[model samples]
Target: MKNLVFNKLEPGTNIPYELLLLADETVEAINQYIFDCAVYLLNDGLQNIAVMALHPNSNTELEIKNIAVIESYRSQGIGSILMGKAKEIAKENSCTILTVGTSDTGFQQIRFYEKNGFVKKGIRKDFFTDNYPFPIYENGLQMRDMIILSHDLSE
Candidate 1:
């Protein structure tokens, strides 16, 4: 974890307002509690991505709240590495699970999480309706819900 750099995006600066509309307090609290948001620079051997706001869900679970990678640096397995690190940290702490929420804007992320072995557990209806500037769409379909995805670290 020491080698990874975590950066917090300014409350309303880095993240889209639509996202904040739904989870502002959660983000605020995470910014205050987490030591750092992890980032892997692009200049350093082709790995440029950031993972931020890791927080404890409880004694047995940890949440991966935010992850971002530069568009040019994406699809090169950087995200997988970040998720691996999160899993490692959770396992080290005896955490049983890892959880993350994806907005309707997180179109590609939905598949990424499932590809990494995460399963859908629930949904928040109309989650991004008020947050995204434009309507959210998936496969030409409008997204009107937020899905909760989880991976079991203990298994």
Candidate 2:
């Protein structure tokens, strides 16, 4: 993490597609909300290692639309740093809640979010099946629903 820098990219700036694809399933899905979201890049003075995108979901809620760290950088606290930045942004915007959603099959992701102080809020049943043109699988299990989680920024 030497020379770590977190930079917020200008809206509509071209993003690192490969880095974003590490978290999202498809290009279409990534494009769906990216243009409207605030994109952030984490670099180690060499190359981009992680990305996070966030957008307002409502007057009081900010949603983490995408978050991904380079595969080699996982478990090194980069994701936690991104989550912490997201919370800071949410609070700065006077948002009361910060939300994120992941594939139901993302076991590690669920645990990661929980460890970051997010709590289960609800489920979007058949979200993947309804939105994605193809099936998505994680950890050998097919993805169907979306598990929505939220953190209380007001706290």
Candidate 3:
């Protein structure tokens, strides 16, 4: 698990970045609840650029609970690389599906996932209502629905 290029992120700041990226829990809850996660860094060790959360799924798929790239790191292909590592790990573990969920308002994330060949499989409306401290909006739209995306790793 540690063989991949992984780094350590400051707990509070990093968790909020995860929340902003996916509307997850606060930094505190994330620090306490979601313990199985990883961070990606540049080879130069300049930035803790990305985050990923790994956990067992109800089905055979492996859930990428969270993935994020800092704003300065966006548009540079770092997120894709991080996801590629996650997909590789999933395949190595004999998992057939790479699954993730994001708010409908996360337009950039939706585009990123779609660009990476993940398909929109389902939605859970109001998935973030009680989970986040404040309402989240993006691209002039409020994020109330959670969209589930999946990529078939077996293919």
Highest lDDT against the true fold, candidate: 2
Q: Write the per-residue lDDT of candidate 2 for residues 1-155, one digit (tens) a residue.
A: 56899999975677878999999988999989988899999998888999999999898999999999998889999999999999999988999999999999999999999999999999999999999998888999999999999999777
Candidates in order, TM-scores: namely 0.65, 0.97, 0.77
Give the candidates in order of TM-score, highest first. Answer: 2, 3, 1
lDDT of 3 by residue, 24-89 (tens): 546654554366654334332653556676666744678887676667667878778878888887
lDDT of residue 79 for candidate 1: 76
Better of 1 and 2 by lDDT: 2
Q: Report the poorest 10 consecutive residues by lDDT, candidate 3.
A: 38-47
Clash pairs, candidate 1, are: 5-39, 6-37, 6-38, 7-37, 18-131
Clash count, one per candidate: 5, 0, 0
* Order of quality (lDDT): 2, 3, 1
